[model samples]
Target: MEKIVIIGGGFAGLNLVKRLDPEKYRISLVDRNNFHCFPPLFYQIASSGLVSANICFPFRREIKKMKNVSYHMGHVKQIDIAAKKVTTSYETLEYDRLIIAAGSTNNYFGMENLAEETFGIKTVAEAAHTRDEILDRLERGAICHDPERRRRLLTFLVVGGGPSGVEIAGAIGEMKKYILSKEYPELKPDDVTVTLIEAAPQLLGAMKKKSRDRAVKDLESLMVNVRLNTGLKSYENKYVTFADGHKEYYETLIWTAGVKGEPIPGLPPETIGRGNRIIVDEYNRVKGYEDSIMAVGDIALMQCEAYPNGHPQMAQPAIQQARNLAKNLNKGEFRHKFEYLDKGSMATIGKNRAVADLKGFSFSGFFAWLTWLFIHLISILGMRNKLSVMVNWFWNYLFYSTSLRLLLRPTRFPLRKHWGD
Candidate 1:
């Protein structure tokens, strides 16, 4: 049997493995994280709607039933194409065929100073840190008597008007209205401000024109300040300078602005393209490698007719690409090229409002929210995770209060300040 080694146990790698029959090959999957996180609802976790553990599913337990499959937990440093071996932190391994599903990272767009000032919502760790950071600022605001400084600390700026940005802004809006109102009776709902900024002229740039128009209107109705075709030109600490020569101080800055593929060492610079994606041919073969190496998911820049530049680096595209490649790899027939199956995209603004663009149909409001919740719940990894999340949502819906709001504090104000507020 042939040996297959995959790097990055994200949606792409795990889904690919599911499509492959274990008896046909020996497979080893590697990732820096031991658990698989559901990416769609990461905003809920960040906004305190869900706990970190609730969204995480251990990879080993989930994949344990497969006989021929194995798992490794580590960061892959380089690929030695000449020897057909991959060098990771623990050990070096060889494979008859390789899949580079190694994921993406937050892109700063070469603005080093600004990158230091902003945070990206990409990983479970980052998401949790962001949640703690927001709550920490609120605690400080509660005691400070300076009204102007308090307003600044309470003001939240969300950069990048994409789905993550939209969702985060909406969630924060809900937090300001419902969660904050219930928790801090001293602070009025009007004291907390949530702003959404995007360099593009509209939000959800890839969606239909009407959908984008409706999203902006819905967000405004939700009291989320939407600023389009605008962004931070530079930032230092809490002060951000925008392109319009306006500088503002904000305590909480949620950066969902940009992303670039995580750079893999040892691949020639020529193989990399814009956004650091590994340029792959129509068949998803990494450029300059005939059959020994391939890439999928966010790491691969697959060029095709429907997606002349490359398909959207979303979960559905990744899952479809992985399955297509797995089918060809299990057999000797490697003739088919990977094609994306367009499953419509959706975004939720608040409790009962959302926008969805299905293949030929577009829906919004209550039905769209239902679609969003059902799809996300079904996509969650394990049964316990699903049940825990469902219960939390149920309780929140009825009571308008999050179950776990107590600060897991370090107990000393000085120590908390040292951690950087």
Candidate 2:
């Protein structure tokens, strides 16, 4: 049996592992974290709609069912293509075949301050941290006697117009509309603000024009300030300067602006393409070593006639590519070319407002919101997670509140005296 090593236990890697024939290949999965986190629901975690465990699954528990698979908790330091070896933080492993699915990281567009200060919802930990920060800021704002300082603490800015940005902005808006008055009685409804800024012409650039229009309308209805063609120039000392030379004071800034592939070291510079993704052929094989080394998911860029710029870095594309690569690897031959199926896009704005574009048809309103909920709930991995998320959603829908709004932090205590003393 051939020894196969896969890096990153993301949507792509997990799907690929499940499809591969375990009896014919011994597989080892490596990741910095020992859990697989669902990125789509990360915003929910950040907004206190869900807990971390609802979307995260332990890798060891998942791999136990596969007799031929083992889990390694470590970060990939380098990949030696010629030697066919993967060097992790813990140890080195030799593989007959290697798969790269390391995924992407937040792109700050060379803005150091934004990268350092802004909150991100890319991982479970980050999302949880963001939630705590938001809650902490609210708590401070409620007690702040100075009007200016309190205003700054109450203002929330989300930079990005994509699904992640829209969803999070909407979630925050919902909290302001429903939860703020009851929980933080000191702060009035008009005192809190949720602003969403998009540098592009419209939000959800990939979606249909109708959907984009609907998203903007829904967000505005929720009292969210939607700014278009607005770019961030700088963020310093709790103040944000826009490209138009205007400045605003805000304590909370959530950045879902962009993401770039985090390619592992030791690959030839020429193999790296736009967005720092490894250039791969249609068969999902690395440029130089098409036979042994393969790249899939967000880390790989395979351009075709339909997608000259490469497939959109999304969950569907990543999952599809992994399944396709697994089939080809199982056959021991790169017989088929990878074809991406565009399954359309959807984004929810608030309680009963959402937009969905399926093929050529577009819809918005409560029905679209229901569709969005159903799809995401079904796509989540693990039955327990699905049920937990469902219960949370149901409870939130009925009460307009959630019990998961918790600001978790480590507790420190003073040293205690010995029992003998």
Candidate 3:
């Protein structure tokens, strides 16, 4: 049996393992974390809409049934292409074939200070921290008599018009309307402000124009302040300065603006392309490489006529590419080139409101919202997760409440027994 090594247990990598026959290949899956997190529903975690365990699936449990599949939780430090070896924190791995599926990271675009000052929701840990900060700020703001500090703590600003930003902003808006109204009556509905600032003229720039308009309308209905044509110039503690000389104050700025490929070291510079992705051929094999090495998911830039640059860094393209490559590998010859099928895109804006562009036909409102819910429920990894999410959604809908609004703080920040008495 040939030995195969795959790095980064993301959507692309996990699916690749599923397609491969363990008996035919000795597979080793490596990742920094032991579990795989669903990225699409990360906003719900950040807004206390869903728990972390509801979206996480352990790879150990997943690969236990496979006889030849092994899981290693280690940080991959380098990939030696010439030697066909991978160096990690625990040990080194030599393989007959290698697949690099390492995903992208938050791209600050040379804004070092902005990256430090803002919050992001790219991972489960990041989403948990965002939730913690939100709960902490709300608790502190409720007791503060100082108007300036209270207002600053209550104001939530999100930078980006993309799906992550839109979803998070909408979740926060709904959180304030439903959760805060019942739990923290001391804080009025007008006390919390959810503002979404985008540099583009409209939101959801990737979706159709009609869907974009519907999203804007839906967001407006939720009382979310949509700021368009606004660019971020600088950010400091509790203050954001815009390009137009306007300044805003907020305790946290959820930066969902952009991301770039997370390429490993020890690879030649020529193998890298725009957006830090590794350029690959039609069969998802790295350029200039024969067939020993391949790249897939967000890190692979496979250019074609329809997508001259590359396909979108999305779940569908990544999953499809992984499955395609696995099929060709199983055939022992490069028989199929990857072709993307755009299944359509959708984004939810609060309860019973969403916009979807399905095969160029645009729709919004209740029907779109139902479609969004159904699709996401089926996309989740395990049955337990789907059921947990569904139960939470139903409970929330019934009483307009979410029970997972707990502030988890570090031990260093110990609470006083009697309000610092």
Candidate 4:
């Protein structure tokens, strides 16, 4: 049995484990967090639509059934490619083969100030923090005397036009229209504002033109301010300066702007490409390291004729690459070149509104929403998580209420400032 060490317990690494034969490979999985977080539904956590536990799964419990698989919880500091050693926070791991599927992190694009001030919803903790900030602002605004301050507290800004940004903007809009007004009667519905800023001319740039237009219209119908041909210049505490030299005031700035690959150290500089992704060959093997190393998920950049750049940094590509690599490893030789099966994409814009581009057929509205719900539900990891999400969806649909809106603030002045201060 080969000693296979997999770094990062994200979608790619975990799927690789499932596809590999334990009898043929002794696996070691390492990640900073002991649990795997479902990224697709992370917006739900930030919006208070679902709790973190509903989407997070513990790795220890998952690997308990696999006899040859071991779990290590730590961050990889460096990978010694020459020695076949991976130096982590805990110990030096030696492996016959190493798989790098460490995934991605928020790309602040060199704006350190904006990165510090803005809230991101990438992890469970980050999502929870954003939710806390939103609820805290609402609570403070309810009794605030200054109208300007109150308005600032109620304003929400999402700084991207991708799926996460669209979903977040829509969720916040629906929350204001449905949840906030009912829960905090002192706060008027008009006081809350949800604005989505996109650097691109259209939202969901990868989708078809009709689908993008449908998403914009749906967001507008839900009372979300969709700003296109606009970009962020700077964020100074409570003020947002746009690239067009316009300024807007908001308390919460959710940074869903972009993401870059989270590459680990030790690989040659040439193996890395734009967006920090590890450049791989047709077989998903790291460039110049065909036998000893491989990469998958958002971190692996395999540029082909169809995608001269690389496949979209998405779950489908990551999982497919992992499976393909596992199959090749099982055959004891690289047998096939990895090909992406483009399985379409969808984005939900509040309750009965969504846009889907499925194999060139674009559609929107209630049917699209249902399709989105079904696909996401089936894509979730565990049975319990799927059930919990379904129950939450039904509950929100029937009553327009979210029970997970607890302000779990860990520090004093979690919002960085107080109302009328």
Candidate 5:
């Protein structure tokens, strides 16, 4: 039996395996995580609109039906190309073929300290951590009596004007208006400030001009402080300095600026391109090895006619490429080269404000928001998870928000007795 080893088990890896036949190859999937996190709804989790369980699906549970595919929770340490084997934390994997689906990481733009200080929504655990961080600051504000401290603590600085940043800031904005109002009366809606900083002049620079204009308008309507043509240059403890000689002190900073590809060892430095992505041909195969090894998702650089620098590093492109590659992999080189289909892009501002740019048609406002919800709900894996998320969304729509908004405790605390001190 031929061994097919996959490095990462996210959207790309899982989607590739979905099209694979059991009889042809004995599949071995390796990931650092045990659960597959649905990336799209991570913002909902961070904003306290959804729970952790709603966004996380067990990969083992989902794929236990396939007898050929064996899932393992391990990290890939190194790959020995000459020996045709991989060194992992668990064991050495000798593979007949290799697929590198290792995804991207948050780009701090060379600012390492800022990366450490900021909270980014990349994984399930990061989302949970962001939620806890946001909640903890708010709770801390309720107890702190100092006016300046309260002001600093309540301010949330979201870096980048991309979909993730915009959506997160928007969600936090909604939490302030609808939910946080009913919960914390002491703090006014104005008290909780959500700042969105972008290096570009307009928000969602990837979208159309009309859509970008509408999105900026929608966000400004929600009173999200929009700073354009500004970048985070340097940072200390709580202070962030921008390129334009402007700085702000923020207690909570959510990073969504940019991302780079996951590290691949034992590869020549020349093959690596911008964003640390592995440079590959349009066939989704590594530069030299067209048959033996392949690359996909955010890590792969499929520079083509439409995308000279490779496709946009988004979930849609990754999933589409994976599905296409899987079919082509089974069929051989005679198969047509993969071309990305542009469905659309959306950014949700608060509860009712959203903008979507389709291939020809563009939409905004309440209807667009509804479309966004339905698309996300459908994209999520598992019937049980979809139903749970739908029900919770409806519940949130009915009631203002959750009454049980407590900061998640990662570790249990011990009982301490207080005498007559």
Candidate 6:
């Protein structure tokens, strides 16, 4: 059996592993983390609507049924293409076929200071940290004596008008409206501010005009301050300076602005394309390599007539590309070209409010919200996770609140003295 080494256990790599024939190939999957995360619902985790475990599934448990597959928990340090060896943090492995699916990282656009200070929801840990930061600020704000400090502590700013930004902003807005006053009686609804800033002219740039308009309206209705055509120039000492020269004080800055491909080291510089993605052909084969090496998901930028630039870096495109590549590998030949199927785009604002742009038409309001819920619910990996999410959602919908607000902090135990001490 040929050895197949795949990096990343995200949507692309995980799907590809599942599709590949166990008898024909020996598969090894490497990732920094030991579990797969549902990124779309990360905002819910940040907002205390769902916990991290609700969306994350262990890789070992997932691949246990596959006889030919093994999971390695480590980060890929470098890839030696000529020798066909992958050097990870823990071990070095040789492969007959190498697949790169290392997804993406938060793009701070050279703003290093902002990157360090701001919270990002790109990963499970980041989402948990964001939730903790928000709650911490709220607790501090409740007892703060200084008026300005208290105001800043209560103010939350989300940069980026895309789906992640919109969803998180809306979630925070809903929290401020429905949960804040009840949970923290010291802080009124008016004390908290949820602001969403978009550099673009409108929110949800990929969606239709109607959907974008609906999103803005819904956000505004939820008491979120939507700021369009506003770009962040700098962030210093809890103050964000806009491109327009105006500055605003914010305690928390959640950056959902952009994501660049998390390309592995050792690849030729020329192969790296826009957004740091590895340029590939229609068959998802990496540039300069014939068939032994390939890249899929957000890391691969395959240009075509339909997508002249490249397919949108989304879950659907990643899964589709992975499936296509898996089929070709299983056949022992590259018979099919990867073509992206643009399913649709959807963003949920708050309860009974969402926007969905489907194939034939676009819609907003309660039905769109339901469609969003149903689609995400079914797309989740594990049955137990799905049930847990469903239960959490049902409870939240019925009570207009969630009880998963406990701040999960690391327990710091005192160091035990040695026998001599």
- Top lDDT hit: 6
Per-residue alpha-carbon lDDT of candidate 4 for residues 1-421, written as tens digits (9 for 90 to 100):
7999999888899998888888899999998888988898889998899999888889998888987999987788899888999998778889999999999999888887876798999878789989888889988999998988898788899999999999999998888777776798888878989999999899999899999999899888778999999999889968888898988888899999999999688889999998999999999999999998999999999998999889999899999999999999988899988999998989999999999999858889999999999998887778999999999999999999877889886766456442211
lDDT of 2 by residue, 32-142 (tens): 888998898999999999999998889988878788999988788888888999998778999999999999999888896787789999888789989999899888888
Model 2 TM-score on a 0 to 1 scale = 0.96
Error of model 4, residue 107, in angstroms: 0.8
Name every residue pair that clashes in candidate 2. Answer: none
Q: Model 3, residue 111: displacement in angstroms?
A: 0.7
> Per-residue alpha-carbon lDDT of model 5 for 86-188, expressed as tens digits?
8877788889889899898888878888667889898787888999998998888878788888988998999989999999988887777776668876777
For each candidate in the order shown, give its overall lDDT on alpha carbons: 0.83, 0.90, 0.88, 0.90, 0.83, 0.92
Alpha-carbon shift of residue 257 in model 5 (angstroms): 0.4
Clashes of 3: 0
What residue runs in model 5 are displaced by over 4 Å at the alpha carbon? 412-421
Model 5: lDDT to the true structure: 0.83
Q: After superposition, how far is residue 192 of candidate 2 from its true place, in Å?
A: 1.1
Q: Whose lDDT is higher: candidate 1's or candidate 4's? A: 4
TM, every model: 0.95, 0.96, 0.95, 0.96, 0.95, 0.96
**Model 5 pairs whose backbones collide:** none
Superposition TM-score, candidate 5 onto the true structure: 0.95
For model 3, what is the C-alpha lDDT against the true structure?
Answer: 0.88
Residue 86 in candidate 2, Cα distance off native in Å: 1.1
Each prediction's RMSD over C-alphas, in Å, is 3.3, 4.2, 4.3, 4.0, 4.8, 3.5
Candidate order (lDDT): 6, 2, 4, 3, 5, 1
Return the lDDT, model 6, position 329: 92
